[model samples]
Target: MAVAAAAGAVGVPAAADTQTAGAGGSQQSDIVTLDLYNLTDIHGHIEPVFDKYTSEAGLSHMACYLGKARKANPDSQFTLLGDNIGASPFTSGTQNDNPTVEALNKMGVFASTIGNHEFDKGLDVLKARIDGSDPTHYAKINFPYLGANISGMGTYLKNYRMWQSPSGVKVAFIGAIEDDVATKLFPGTVDSLTFAKPVPVINDLARELKTVGGYVTGADGSTGTEKVKADVVIAMFDNDVERSYPQMGKYVDGLMGGDTHKPYYFTKVRGAEGNILSAVASGSFTDNLANLQLKYDRKAGKVVDSAAVRIPAAEVKKCGDDPQVKAVTDAAAAKSESIKNTVITSKAGKFYRASQEDANHVKGENRGAESTLGGLIGDVMKNSFRTLDNRPIDIGVVVAGDIRSDLATDSGKITVGDVFKVMPWSNEINYVTMTGAQFQKLLEQQWKELDAKSSRPMLKLNFSSNVKYTYDPARERGQRITSVLIDGKLIDPQAKYTVAGSSFLLSGGDSFTAFGDPEVKASKRTVPNRLDREWFGQYLEKNQNVQPRKAKSSVGVSVKEEPLKDGMVKAKVSLRGLSFSGVGEPRVEKVTVKFGANSVTASVNNTLYDPNAAQYSAIVTADGIGHTDTPADVSARVRCSGRAGQTVHIPLTVENEAGTELVGAVQGLGVDVTCPAADGSVAGGGAPGAGASVSADKTPVKVNRLVRTGAGVSAILILSAGLLGMGLSLRKRKIG
Candidate 1:
């Protein structure tokens, strides 16, 4: 269906990717060319933005490119890989993503796979948007949402829709979403849905199209009248890594992937039978479009060759935006500006979410660690829910994943738009009663099973200030949680406690299924759920000025030791989970370990290069007040940014006084003192450098230097004597 004449005449675009494959031959009447264009992870970016912090390419420019490309080749079909909506910006997000729908209608897309974010509200809300049944939204989407691996759509979804050329050369476009979408959504919203692995599903569909070549069937297996076999297959998945699914190239000529939001193209995936498949990834934020072309020979009934090129969104500048799409984007911007400017709170301190640092110390958002913002949100939710619902909730919980943005005022005032971006899902407060054992299970669930398709190996759930816990990641999964305390008291395993949070979390969102237990779900719901964003705004407005939590509510503490020795001892204590991301979270610089009243020198080797660097060693000695009969009290502490204390009392096992006694033998004014046991315990390899010890009753005094040898000591006395003699001569001359 793709015409060669409509293409090439437009000339090369600016900064177009140089990657291209399979040039065409001369005078080919039997050849059929199909042009396919795709975009992924738009996330409702509909308006052009050029700001100090960021600049978005927006839908108007994206639509301009699509219009020109499709017009140049009438044989083409505009399509999307995934992430057409949800997690949108203020312009579209404020209006329930209606502007995005309107913009997509102007682009004229044929079909799209479902990104995980599409399920943010639930399956029903997604359907309502797709069919334009909701009167509150904008326009009806002309594109069909396709997913071969997803069930519970009844008959609305399709697997592969064939596009036939004039001479009957058919190319089927197959769509399948990632398998783990269910885990990322609210439980009640998707209880009826089932998402399967897309790799096997795509393989099965390719095999059937190649061998069977029968009538197309609906999602429910209802066969349709149209019958055809694909001469070429282009598969779309909600993944960026082409290497992850090596077996995918069986019958596919090209692939488009999404959901890492990285801008990259030109990866070759090896197909079955040693055939190489061209893999192309467009960019997120509507920044680029992946263009793929295929040449099929009618005589051979197979695709002869294919090539791909990534078209950047900047190319639209040369051609300009489509007038109709630009109008919609501008309208959206105007509509949301008032709400965005409405101040929600006065000037406030910054609150930052968790982030991860790479080996080179480059940082980005990480949902695996706790942060000050998450803790504050948890407190806000708990207090607001208790007062509003008239319920006695023992604990409040909020996961790192739920917090999408931070609260930092650029204009010296917090706005509604800023708060909305932080809690965009508009989740409501829900209460569930869970026993202490189940709560422990939920805490243990932080270390989740690693997924090939997902990035989070561990997810952190931030609890209110009243809750404290310690975890050791080195331990087995279920046994990682060593202690859990609520309200300064050890949690009783049999006690029933009511916890409040988003309905998604209360129902075990993000795979924390302990909260989804039968007893927890069946608990009485005496009051109606309150929207979390409204409550949070009220909480902030009442306080006027907000500040981040100064210290971490929960900490990770563990100890590793060699055999115990009482005097002049050393030990390694693992101080981990201290390196949290963002300015608001405390940044631990060094750790200190104290034995009785004697504090020894310590050194820490914390680095992103090694996971074992969390283990810091400090020298502990029985030299001063540590010279006690009973075990000396050991305190492990940390010095972090903006604060100097996190005193964690840890137990130390010191060697008994029996072996440590210095055996003194006196004979004619010569005394022999034999030290205990040749320095073996916490000795040898990892001990810190020895330094002069401080007495138990006094502060440390810094000398110019330590005089190590006898020669150095004599040199100091000679200098002192010369100075004294010079002073006496000067005094005698003055008297004369």
Candidate 2:
């Protein structure tokens, strides 16, 4: 450590030689430069990976760059701001990111703050990782994990740490993880830890570091006290650059930020107290390096000026890989190489997980859209149990987050390593034998099952290829799912159906409370115990080649709730969510809309490489219905590049000339209809001779809400068709 301090003194004066003007005496140089290097949101990417960026920072390259910085400034130390590990690629994630810690140790990283992902396995595991106590691996983190504003920290964690520069300038790094970390994590994953606002807690600690050390409540639960000693304070915090709070300049000279993953640098941030601070943030996945240079006036006993920059480590070429870090990386790669390289399917083709692209062509995962990879995983989950039980699994579900990446290989072979990168968490699959009613609730829960919304407003769940559904976002939450069909038949509400999914989700991870409900799991048919990764591998083995499906499993449909006019029952309909927002994806070309007894075909330009959204508008007219009280169903069948979408029924009322809403409530997998109002205003009111005055522009006498008769879908579909066959004029057919 003494050599490290001395090395940092390169091109700097000794402490005694630099002290000047403190007592207004003859002065020497007053400045001492201290350099500190930082990395954030590395996300365990120890291996070199390439994408849109021209260059990539594998640990070896990053080490090389940091090595140069350290040689120039011997007092400098490498620090990580958080997310140094977790949510990793297969090379590091398979071994619980042990290699990442080993690599960091080899690089001589001084300290780090805890990222939200650090708590992915909970506090016990984090402590084990911090203290070299994990039973399976022996690689211990050689440095401390700091979090000043975090409560419930174990003994392995500290609030702040100290670093001394060669010119005798000591820096106190006070750390605070992002304040809203818990919202991004799974429920109950961080129940024991409480995160407070970072800026306020940081100010309080800096106050203590600069003044007398004393007893402070909640500083440590057991001791209720803490005292930090240092000459000046720096910040190691996880924060969004936009919300980093310039107020921190009041007590700290420089700030290091992470968690949002965007790289940034602020040369001068003026605090309320007129002090200036520098802030730096490095981009995610070893893409960038952040540096802070502080000029301390030893005689003045305070920081005078500071500058910071976020270096683009990826672009600087010709930096020879640091041998020590390369050795560590090589060992870790060798440890996971065998299984990762084991070929699962030689004939594997390209498959994609859904994503949304920005104007710059940068892609970010969009969990709201249905992905082909998600569909395939869903198939595997259900098929794994196929024929194993007397009754087949009625449905399978895949959470979008579980499929982390797309599948492709330059060698035309997909390996076990490839699958691990996509599904590295290794969540176990479980079957929940829930009632049909519960399934409906689960489907509606795609919007999140709470009155309050989540950061991601919608987390779309992918269903087995056999399942299809339609919804209307115009409807209120919890009542959005309009139709659900399995194998061309309506889902029976009271029927017991076995649904398979990962244990993480079935046990209520990601806010899916429907699967974790006690009543749903209470069914006698509920089953458990299957590895999701194992099933995926088995599926690849059995299928031999990957077949990509282009059609989306779900679509959005909404019909204007207006009265049917005259002999022609005309209603305008709006449809969307037909396009899959993925690379190399095709949009819907043709949509056959069937409403009530009328069917209409609309052209949607089903062409490959068309840079247009797949959306359509159409009108359905029922000319035969007079003023009866019967309700009708509306839905569409989408024709895409690969296949056709499901035609699930959407419930709608047949309004009368007086604009009275008809009673139609389809429950389960049936076309159930309720009786209309006694007034003749509703079509097919079934009231003795309902009124029949109809015009689109006519003013409505009154508005009646939808009525429910609770008729079974099977009986209604059959009876309606049979009645139309008899030419009884109960409903008319129109096609265009």
Candidate 3:
């Protein structure tokens, strides 16, 4: 009778109650302040970014937030939505996914669903990272990883686990990857398992809670007969952003997740009108935190007080005090220190900040603003792989978005911790084979994409390191690709080409529609997208002397011009940011000039502003090379010859002991070369920059200079370029 009464209290059928209960009636409360904390898509950015020297990163900050949530209310519950891994930066990727999990364990996450990135490194790597005996991968973790819709591995691997709060109320958490995990992962990563739609699997699990006779399911699926019939449902999923599901909010109490870079918090969801529903968004690669609070009542099953939203500064400080949180962060930091040298040394050029007005990094000959960082990362990953797998990679494709911070080649030491701060998640390596048709399709998409305006905002492919390919925007889309090769061998359109990529890409990330081509064939899987993991492993195994130094550097410019009646070319040229040494300062570097594929005079200015005149010119341009007067910086442009039918690409090859980290986006220019028309080809004209014009009526770059001669004696050039560039250079100067 008591069990029946308790079930009725929460709106559940009383007849289903089977457990006997004591007489003292359950306590009920009105105005329950359920604190719901949601942590979704934490790609291992565990640290906090306050300034340069003292930022905490990745699992540390997350753990701190969790500790704060626990204190905010003893009743508060923690949950994660999905996509806590894959496509992570060098830190977790290099480390094999262990330190990240250790930090999560310390954060006290109760439960989570599987996100697409979770499978990026392949299943074996995931398993080893999660359950490895080594301290790095499986040290922490007492929470449950629930996957209901995913079939296979019944007893082989566990399912959704439960976690009971101090109130003895149990929450059942089930995890699910997007139903398309097979396509997203290497063909074999999940060979032993399959996934199902998240909604049905979660609903079925929720119904089973009734079988416990009013006992709520807790972490590890343990059941207990509590007078309160409340159950907290946590579902983690990674799905296409286009497919909206209102039912998820209606059905679950809390959902913290990733896959989409956007954040979604306490917006009122429908089904939870009387209850509470919340979703946590992907943890910002930089600048953000999320929280979810869960509260229960005798009237409603489980209520989400708040979902994926930023934590107050006061709360951040509070969580920082937790011992468990600090420990996890320390471990990651320690592990990060191991691989810091390798990445720094592998950099061919230095990182320059990108302006808000400029396009971010991409993988072309010029490399754009993020090219150097991208190059260094690619080199490190490739080199690490070679050492581990005993094979050299043909080409490497790393997205520019993955590089969160500018590489500090100009005296700002980029440590292992710094690498971790920049790249925090773990994604393993996976290889695939694509037919000539598929390869051509991939290349064609890029050319067509370049021709279209904002057809895809998230398309920046950084192909640096040892990979080589040519993009002739002069040809029609799909046919623009003339050739594809591996190790200098010509690609046969009908034959398969082995390609290396992050598991995320193998499954198709960032709307890479080409990966799904029918002719593609995927190879075996490996562990870690986090380059740092492999870096550390290799360093430790080989125990070689690791030294960080800058490598290559170069400058590129893009100019757009119109043929006037006078026969002289009238055009606009943009001075892209300077690309410099990837690891150390350039031994000897100089920029060359060219005009319409021909030689042109080039000169440079070392100073952006003439203090004597108290005036500044658009930072000078050397002959054709844009070299800034600022030490270790170069940005300029030249008035070169232009021909109506000829377009030339000036390749700024920086030859040093190694590669340079000079990647700048060439904007303010357009390639107007006409391509041969093909059957059913889309019309392309007016160059890519049709509707844009030069608006000098803007104040985007500002300069502030300060001289200091002390222990760290330095002259700081505080040049506030655009937003991206602001994060780099500006405050620091290159030392001679």
Clashes of each: 0, 18, 103
lDDT by residue for model 3 over 1-736, one digit each (tens)?
Answer: 0000001111111121112133222334422444545556666555554543223334555555555445544556666656665545555545655556666766666666666666666665555545554454444345556566777745324456555555545555656655655644545677777666665665566555433423445445465556333366566554422122344644466555555444334344544224445554433442334544444553655453543345422335434444665575566657765555643333222443221210111111111223445655555555556413555654555654455555454453345545554444434666556665565566444321311221122234544344433322222234323223344344445665555556566556544567766545334345454444345345323422333324322232333333321222233333223433232323233333322333222333322221111011112111111242322222222222232222222222222223322321221112222211223111233222322222132101111123222233222111112111211222221111
Q: State the weakest 10-residue window (summed lDDT) of model 2.
A: 616-625
Candidate 3 lDDT for residue 524: 38
Candidate 3 all-Cα RMSD: 16.2
> What TM-score, over all chains together, does every model reach?
0.68, 0.67, 0.52
Question: Roughly what TM-score does model 3 have, to 2 decimal places?
Answer: 0.52
Cα-based lDDT at residue 301, candidate 1: 74
Comparing 1 with 2 on lDDT, the higher-scoring candidate is 2
lDDT of each: 0.58, 0.60, 0.42
Write model 2 residue lDDT over 1-736, tens digit each, in one string. 0001112222221222343232223334667667678888777778776654223478987887777765555556678898887777788888888888888887867778888778876777888887778758646787778888888876767897766555556677788875666655656777887778777888888877777543321212233235535677888877754345456757677778876444556677766477777777765677656677677787898878776654554443246588998898899899888878888888866667655432223333556567778888888877767533666877889887677667765555888888887787767677778876788788777774222333344677888888877665545556556666676566666677888877777776666778767876554243444467778888999999767665666765544433333323334444545545545564554455555555554544221121111111111000000111122334322111121121223333322223321222231222222212334223333332234322232321222222222231111121122112221122311111
> lDDT, candidate 3, residue 601?
27
682 Cα displacement, candidate 3 (Å): 22
